[model samples]
Structure formats: structure tokens, C-alpha cells
Target: MDKLTIALPKGRLFDPVVEILREAGVVNRELDDDSRKLILEDEQLEIDFLLSKAVDVHTYVEHGVADLGVVGKDVLLEAGASVYEVLDLELGSCRLVVAIPEEAGITSLEELPSTGRVATKYVNVAQEFFDQQGIQTEIVKLNGSIEMAPLVGLSDMIVDISSTGRTLRENNLIEIAEIARSSARLITNRVSYKTQHQRIKNIIDDVKAVISKQ
Candidate 1:
């Protein structure tokens, strides 16, 4: 029997998703996040687990290396990958927002200068949001330390993720606008959906039952 492969993101959402797979009877073994093994196979259940960085999950799925991928909604929007975004797992919820230094006090984005500079890893999403709002800003792409950009005067604003707002507050920044609310999502490769319809549908149904109870 061919093993069904599911790609799971390596960071925050991994353990809970692994637990969900267990509860759904898709896999019968406990997978360790701390383990060095990136790929784990469950012989009894005929399933393969592909553990990878959160950002690359979409790429794996798009290329059919993974039949299905569990990743964040932000990743899908940022990567703009061609895959079926089949379900939202409702795990690791967060918001992508437009944030400016707290010292530049005002309640709304409108109160800020129309032309400013923004920093973020989400270039495409941020560009679209600002354009829609008629705000013209130079966007700088940063891989990390997005909050520090505004504090250090590298940019006047930042488009980044805020989970509890604690990080922004601690860094003396305030969220001016929310671009999107995101959570973990289930995505499937186009070809895999057609080739492994029954197997994939069964798992989706099983996972849905677990989520519906919540």
C-alpha cells in the first residue's frame, strides 16, 4: 500500500497537529518535534510525516513532494502558491497588522503621514494593503527584527504579525491597521487530490469532526 504523505510545519503548530492526526486515526504513533528526524513514517497506518520549516510547506505541496501540507494562512498569502487551501485547522492564530512607533501617537493610520516607509517580510500582502488605503510607502523586506525597524528609524511603519500584542507594546509600537487574521490551514496538491481522493477525503472528514467539536 502507498503511504499518504502529509507535510507539517516545524515550529509552533507541529505538536498539536501531530496530536490531531493521532486523534483522527490517520497516524498511530507519537512524533517528536525535538527529534532530529525530519521525516517519520508510520508503518502500521501507512502515512509519512514531512517536517519542514513553516515557510517551505507550501513549496513542498506545490511541487507534489507532499500530498498535503499543514501551514499558516499567512504563508499561503505570502507565497501565492497554487494549491487547494482545503481547511483551516484553527491552530496558532495571529494577525498581520500595520504598526508604527508608539511615539507617533494617533488612533488611525489616516493620522500618519500619507507617504512613509514600511518594513516587513510580507511584501506582497503589505503592498496590496497600503495601495488599497491610498498610502504610498517604501517597503523594505526584512527576514527578522521587523519590530526593531521602526524603533531604529529604518522604517516609519512595520507590517508584521501580532499574536498577543505584547511584543509590539514592549517595543513601544502600536498597531494601526490589521491586514489579515491568520491561522493554520490544510492545503493539498492539485494532482494529489485527484490521485488520492478517497484517502485524503477520509482524513479531511476525520479532522473536521475533531475541529467541529471545538
Candidate 2:
């Protein structure tokens, strides 16, 4: 029997996923420490674990490199890859928001420029949001330090995710609008789901059952 290869995200989201998997009696080892190897094996169940970046987990599953993946909804929205977003894990819950400097005196999205500059890592999602609003803003794609854009005058506003809003507050920024509320999700390739229907469904059912209880 071929072992099911599962790609697990390697950051904050991993803890909850591991906990849930343990509850399901699928995960038996620690996934908590850093400086350790990525892959792990649950010998009894013939499960292979591949630890990867949160953003790239979906790609692994989508490409059938791994049968399944645990990723954040932010990644799902941003990537928009052709994969089955099976379950909302409801862990690592947060919201993606558009924010501006508090001192900038921009209280609402409506008051912003028609073609103002915006910065974010989620360029596609950001563009789609502006397109929906019928607004035209230049998107400045940044890999990191998105909040600094408005502060240093690199951009007028930004599109980013927030959990407690503490980062926004500390940066003297306020959320003008929320793009979407996100949580961790279980996703799989369309082909994998079709080919491994019973196995995939069982895992999905087990994970969802655990989530439903919380």
C-alpha cells in the first residue's frame, strides 16, 4: 500500500494541526521544535509528513506531490489554485485588511485616491479587491515589512492580514476595511481526491469531526 503523503505547514498553524491530528490518533510525534528535520513518519499508519512553508503547502498538494496539505485561508485566497478547499480548520483564525496610517486622516476607502499606491504581498487579491470597488490603485508588491510602506511614504495604503490588530495599532495604522476572515484549511489536489477517494475522505471526515467538536 502506498503511504499517504501529507504536507503540513511549518509555522504557527502547525501546532493546531498537530494537535488535531493527535486527537484523531494520526500524529504521534512532536512538530513543535525548530532546527529539526521536516519530514516525519507515522509507521503504524503508513503516513509520511512533509513540513513546508505555509504559503507553499497548497502548491505541494495542488501538484500532487503530496496527497493533502494544511494551509491558511489567506494562502488559498491569494493563490486561487485549482485545488479542493475541503475543510475550514478554524484554527489560526484572522482577517485580511486594508489599512492606512492613522495620521494620514484617511478614514474610509472611499476617500482614497482613484489611482493611489497600495502595497501588499497578496497582489492578486489586492488587485481584485480594488477592481471590485471600481478603484484604480497601483499595487506595490513587497515580500516583507508591508506596514512600513505607508510610514516611509512608499505607498498610501496596504493590503495585509491581521489577527489581534496589535500590529496595526502599534504601527499607528487603522483598518479601513476587512477583505476576508481567514482560518487554517485542509486542501487537496482535485486529481488526488478522485484517485484516492476513500482514503482522502476518511482523513477529511476525521479532521472535520475534530473541528466540529470545538
RMSD (CA, Å), each prediction: 1.2, 1.4
Q: What is the clash count of model 1?
A: 0
Per-residue lDDT of candidate 2, residues 1-214 (tens digit): 5688889988777787889988876677665526387788878788889999899998899898899999999989999977899998889889999999999788888987777899999999999999999899899999998999999999989999999999999999999999999998888889889888998898889887888898
Which one is best on lDDT? 1
Model 2 ranges with Cα > 4 A deviation: 30-35
lDDT tens digits by residue: candidate 1, 79-167: 89999999999999999998888888866877977898999999999999989989898999999989999888899989999999999
Using Cα atoms with residue i matched to residue i, what is each candidate's TM-score against the true structure? 0.96, 0.95
lDDT of 1: 0.90
Clashing pairs in 1: none
